[model samples]
Target chain A: MFHTTFYIRRLHSICGLAVLGMVLFEHIFTNSMAIFGPAALNGALEMMELIPKPIFLGLELGGIAIPLLFHAIYGVYIALQANNNASNYGYCRNRNFTLQRWTAWYLVIFLIWHVGYLRLYTKGITGTPISYELLQNYFQNPVVVVLYVLGMFAAIFHFCNGITTFCMTWGITKGPRSQNVVSVLSMGLCAILCLITLTFMGSYLI
Target chain B: MAEKKVRFVIERQDSPESQPYTQEFDVDYRPGLNVVAALMEIQKNPVTVDGKKVAPVVWECNCLEKVCGACMMVINGRARQACCALVDEIEQPIHLAPARTFPVIRDLLIDRTRMFEALKKIQGWVELDGSWDVKDAPIQNPYTAQTAYEISHCMTCGCCLEACPNVGPQSDFIGPAPTVQAYLFNLHPLGKFDKPKRLNALMEKGGITSCGNSQNCVEVCPKFIKLTTYLAQLNRDVNIQALKNIFNN
Candidate 1:
């Protein structure tokens, strides 16, 4: 049997890559629809609206929310217990390790509030049809806009750096050269993600 | 000419149970003085900056050139051997302390028995089973020999463990050096025969997965062992071992 700490860690990595990662990928692609136009974004939303309510609720709870909640809570546990001696040691990955923990925190806070506010307004509470108007109104508030930008930054950073870590930890990147490839790829991924996410965000303001 | 003076702010504890406090010493700085030499100078004097005669600072050392690995301690906020830490290279009022990761014995020493335990748990040695030296010892490939030579440089100084974040009294991360040791033994032909056993040990609690790959170990290792690289290899090997277990069993 795998060691308990090791097992939990592997599970954490697995849940991170397989479940949460897919959700982020899907959400990003879907949100990138805004780059086309508001109508395009709304049309994309309509297709999603066709999924039966119970099934949709189930997907949100089972597929995204629950797994995400577990990943976040467990991440918090690990981050809290983990220490970083990077200041003394001055290693590059040690800095990344420390930054990963910080980004984990930022992502958790932003996700909770973002998900709650958006989900409740659109589905759980208001049942309002999401449109450019809704986003515009949302972004009108300076605080909301700031939170969204910060949240987007945290999520992208957490995801991108996480990809690099995932590769090494799982042995997918066995050596330095291969890991370097993964690192560069993840950085590119981060760049694309930030551009699209922020581009759409700016469109909402415009 | 005025005596070139060096000041030290070192953490000390009288006994394992006693509280730790800071002690200061001012010494006549000779050119090319290292922390170990400075400690020796202090040991001879046993006097404080405040002019109080105190007990000599206790520390461990041998092969003062940094090879023996006995002289490791945190010098100036970083963990390294006091032996090679030349005085002129670093700042004055250098802060010295026992490695915080391990429990202190007295002044600058801590018990590194857990490291030995980790090595034992991982079965670091190649399995001979009383066949100390086989006449037909397997000839090695040049590449494998090169990798093995790199791993053989580890001196068990406990720097990797001390600088690591996850390692402490509460956590069971066996540190990085032993993981490289596992890979080293796994590469030997006879050692390769028992590879599954060693990999299985790695699968045990406090094994390879505990490493988050912050890589402070590689940075701080005086031997300059590519610890994370071996860890990366060991990670791959462990997975293959798991797969083998699944199919063979």
Candidate 2:
């Protein structure tokens, strides 16, 4: 039971870092195109849509879906088993420890809504490719805009914090000094990503 | 001038199954007095601040110095050795409690048997036989030996476990001390022969994967062991071992 668990845990980290992490960067960059207005955003989406349907399907399934489902499901199991004593311990890292798990829980809900509503349901019912207009229509709901803002923050925090842990998990940053440096860097990246994504969201409201 | 006094608030429990309660005491403030010395003053009197006689505060200590790792407790919300927690350094009205990660045997005495069991689980020693005269052991590289020596300083003090969020009544993590011990022994040339066994042990549930890398263990360790570094190295080792296991079978 545990032998496979060890591998699964490592794989979970790898999925978060190598797989989902890359997808998040791509996602944020693509969304950031909205800052240039609908035309630029749609043009970027059109470019992506040009990929062969089979290849796109394969990438979505193998690169995103399978790893993501495994990461999410196993992540929930790991989070549940955690004994978060940050309330008692109250160290900076301990607080981050608690936040990481909490963000994970939030992301599970947010992802289901974000993907199910935006990706599958919207496209399935409308019989149209996802476009800036479609996203605009979706975000017109005040509740969705609020939910997306919170969801974006959770995803960004989880991914950036996941990077620091991935480094430690792989022994990339072994010492306290190095780990601190990586942590500061990851936070910087998170701040930058958040700024960019928020700007993108703001474009829709205008 | 009036004599100075240091106050103490100790969490007390009568037995393993009993509820815990706090009792207050005042000890004569002596310069250079550590927490253990203050506790000793309380032990001698066995009286509460309410002016009622009570049972003596129970605790464990072998070496009065920090090396024995006995007498570890939560001092002012931090897990550390009471023998080294000087009264002058800490704020007055010191709060003392057993290291809650382990079962409290009494007032501040905790049963560290789980740590011992973890050490055993990791097989934290080299195998030896007395049937024949042993040959010369391999001389270790000085740098490697230094690293090993640093990790070897862990006294099985429950501080790491106490500070670890992953180690508790509800969690299964074996805590950081034993993980470092496994790495320490694996660093030995002879111990390397049994490296697969140690790696297998760490591969089990509540092994290395259970480490959330919150790093409170490194912060609280009195020995200042580079616990995170060793754990990271062990993480790499186990991954490599897992790959080897996959291909070998």
Candidate 3:
């Protein structure tokens, strides 16, 4: 019989790679909003806005619905499978697998609450334009700012760590030299992403 | 710098046909010295504890770095290259033995011919057909170049095979390293030309499906190569190749 860990790792890789590509696409598109001015972004949001009465019920049942449910269920499965409880900080061991498990769990919970608050209810209450101004205002709140910072940090760390493991999983970094290079590069990339998020939030919000 | 005395209990055998025994020795160590260095000190003076003279212990070392993979032995029960194992970092009374996974040649030396044979069976190399000029070989996509650069770092260290449960005496499973190497070649622009041949090799009994996904191979690989990722991708590639073959037939 196949070990459950293999299935989980493989699934996690699939999810991580696809999600990473999606996030990257969104980031580029969102940043491009600057070119057309804040009104353009808000206008686009206004154009695509969903109705709140019956559609709200549909979204609640379907929007953050099926995909989120399936993702979370499988996310938990992967998190549980990747965990190595026996290690308990043993000497002479590689900590990659254990670290991957811990990071996955942390990100899944954080993402759920983030999406719940940001998109689900706030969109209805604020009824505000999804412009740069609105983004600045949302981030200006201390709690929002701190939460965004922490969430972005968690996401970036989890991302780089996953990418490192992904390299290993795909046999890309085949040995010590390649691993050392990828380790250094992954950390550098994560730092760059963190800097971009923090600088933007810092300059615009504060 | 002062010389520190290091103690070691090494498993020794005179030849492939001989019986084995534990031999202890105390050797003067220098800063940044390794298990192999201490063994060399013992070689200079083949004396054992309790005042007994003996034959010099035989092992292997080349490059004095971790690249050659010739210096792999069990240090404190962990399979690693002795050249990179610093004496200061290791716990005292460091026990040394030839890696039990391979046939013991003598004291601290093992025959790693099994790994070489596995590599051979997979034809783990770019076919050197002389048809194309060097300039005309298809330029690699930058992404492909980046991925290939990572996969090319394998040093043929047998740690992955040693840790793999399926790659044992009773089984013909090719283990993780060789399989991953095959995929590396398969990804090349020109290397893709031989995709069918390599996929056929993978479809054989010891091919990609034989991997049990115990993941022990990835855990113990000292080089930190991602064994499972290539294995999974290879599994997908082989399945696709089989479908294509069916249509062609």
Candidate 4:
């Protein structure tokens, strides 16, 4: 059989949009509850627990872990192998190709720290309370705030640019004009995503 | 006939370590002159347009035809083999330079080892050995045979790579030609035995996914091979193969 990475690439793409994209938006919305005060933020967590443990765990592993692993591993493979010369060549397509890989690398570090701190170490694994106070305390650390902002930027860039790439790779956008439209849309989406993240982060910081 | 003057502005690098500079040469043009013929005329005289003595411009050629893929140079910003680049077909004061995608050996010559290495990675050739006989060849469908033959017409002249935005010193992406070879050989009956091997190679870092699908390759191929078609097909096939591996494992 051919290398599994080929399949992984497509799956990485699909999962990025279908699974991660959906989850990412929901996550920000939940975080956005910070504006309503800590109880509302904590309430969102309580509401999330309404889903049964077995099912939620299954969703976490099947929907999140597997897909994320494939995406990250295959992405690293791409980053290691990518030859970035688009700056010299002045090809927009090549520039996007190289940029996507670089963003993926940024996501590697950011995702690890984000997921590890929030999902694993913070709430789910250790059973710490997911509350507005927790976020307040978390934001007290200047270094943590910097990391979170940087992480948000990286994730948003990867997710947005990822949609653009998905459109091209799947032949959804063939013409240069169509590609330009998609790129513009993704950029717009990036701004929106970052705004939501900042809103959530800002509520805690201020 | 009055001496016909042909001008060449060639990009020259003195040695591997030296910086490059351009020098213009005016040579006596002959009838039916191609880029190579004009280069040859300049070679004997080794004199610049201003009559300054200089080393002869350097380049590589084998078949003196499009087949061998040597003599590939940038003529007017387009990558093509110089042997068949008729002087009359293009505009005057033709600018000649080494293919930008590869390291230049000297003036108008580049090391095409990248393409060869890519071929090796993809196992671009049939593995039939001394142990196999001609009678053991597999029967091929006529339509499939024809298409495969077309893909086989790639001269590896680096024109496609030169035109390709994804291929360069910074990229491990193998470009389009070798990927087509993988798809071509995999269609063969005997070659099916080695399909897994070829596909596995393509699944590597510089393999198929690296292609940005810019579609520039088809336009620049000397043979007009249907590279994107094979790439799309293989993209599907490689996915199926991955599913197969996962299920079996």
- Give the number of the best model, judged by TM-score: 1
Ranked candidates (TM-score, high to low): 1, 2, 4, 3
Q: Give per-residue lDDT, candidate 3, residue A145.
A: 78
The residue-by-residue lDDT of candidate 1 on B178-221, one tens digit each, is: 87799988889788887888989998877898888787887889
Q: What TM-score do all the candidates reach, one by one?
A: 0.93, 0.93, 0.54, 0.65
Ranking by lDDT: 2, 1, 4, 3
Residue A187 error, candidate 1, Å: 2.2
Interface RMSD of each: 1.8, 1.4, 8.5, 4.3
CA lDDT of each candidate?
A: 0.85, 0.90, 0.68, 0.79
Give the clashing pairs for model 4: A83-B170, A83-B171
What fraction of native interface contacts does model 3 preserve? 0.01
Q: Put down candidate 4 lDDT per residue, A98-180, tens digits, no spaces.
A: 66777777778888887888889977778896677777888899898988887777777778887877776664664556767
Lowest summed lDDT across 10 adjacent residues in model 2 chain B is found at B126-135
TM-score of chain B of 4: 0.93
Against the native chain B, what TM-score does each candidate's chain B reach?
A: 0.96, 0.97, 0.89, 0.93
**DockQ, ranked from best to worst:** 2, 1, 4, 3
Model 3, stretches more than 4 Å misplaced? Answer: A1-206, B1-3, B130-137
What's the iRMSD of model 1?
A: 1.8
lDDT of 3 at A54: 81
For candidate 2, the TM-score is 0.93
Candidate 2 lDDT over B1-249, as tens digits, reads 798988899999999999999999999998899999988999899899899999999999889889989989999888999999999899879999999889999999999999999999999998866676788887876779999999888899889999888898877989999988999999898898899899999999899999998888988899999898899899888888887888987
> How many collisions per candidate?
0, 0, 3, 2
Candidate 1 lDDT (Cα, whole model)? 0.85
Candidate 2 residues A119-188, lDDT tens each? Answer: 7787656668889998999889999988888888888999998888998987788778888999999999
